[model samples]
Target: MSAVRRLAGFICLLALLAGAVLWITRESARPRESYQEIGLRWLRDEYRLDDATFEKVAALHHAYFATCSQMCRQIKEATRPLLMQTRRQPLSTSTKAGLRQQEQKLCDDCELAAKKHLLQVADLMPEEQRQRFLDDMLSTLETQRLQHDLDMSAHTRR
Candidate 1:
């Protein structure tokens, strides 16, 4: 019937619109670069680091990234069970507490690794540039941390 055809067309049009909106939302939410990439780029531009210094910094960055990536995977693996348990049934208080502690420890380890890497990079910088580099790097880290926390909170709310 003509009415049925019209109804089907309307539904298809609505579906297309919904898909477009979802695509736009996801694209907007995506970051242009990883935080580490952004930090490295910022350091290169802001400090005008020499080639040798840049190479050393890059090496440290790469090493730290590897460690961080491993930590992230471990955390994700650990959290998966907790998430599954929470979804399937109520978890015991002790189990929940243990999971939270493990998560916190993983986060702390990652933070410590980053701090050590930053210190190594700072040591490589000239005395004159060291303070400036630290100031800029700390600011960048704080901004990124705040943004990450905000994003996590928003995600959890959903």
Candidate 2:
């Protein structure tokens, strides 16, 4: 009887642990638009943007991000078959070359989208406000990059 109870308890504990892990994984994998939204909020607050201007900027930013995401997904889908096939087998020279080409193309596509978005944003803003917005974006990007590097280093140490 005691052995039976111990076995049941162990199973229950395992289930609880699995549930906790799934919850954490789902949360982490969640599509977080908070980074972009918060950036817009900061721009409004720090730059004292009026509500109408803020709304227009936010709309434009959101549209650009949406379009960028769609473009990225399409590119990924296009290369995914070859990429997955290469992953399944040992990499040949040809496979490596194809993969490198795909990777470079992906980078170029994303860069193009980013440049287009920046140009659109610049066109939308006045000269002074545009400079401030650019400055804020630069600082935000630098801070994020530094944080990412720190996180990677910490994980490597661990």
Which candidate number maximizes TM-score? 1
Per-residue lDDT tens digits for candidate 2, residues 131-153, read 77777665665575466447534
Worst 10 residues of 1 by lDDT: 149-158
lDDT of 2 at 81: 46
All predictions: root-mean-square deviation over Cα? Answer: 10.0, 10.5
Where is model 2 more than 4 Å wrong at Cα? 1-33, 74-89, 135-158
Candidate 1, which segments miss by more than 4 Å at Cα?
1-39, 82-88, 139-158
The clash count of every prediction, one per candidate, is: 0, 0
Give the C-alpha lDDT of model 1.
0.77
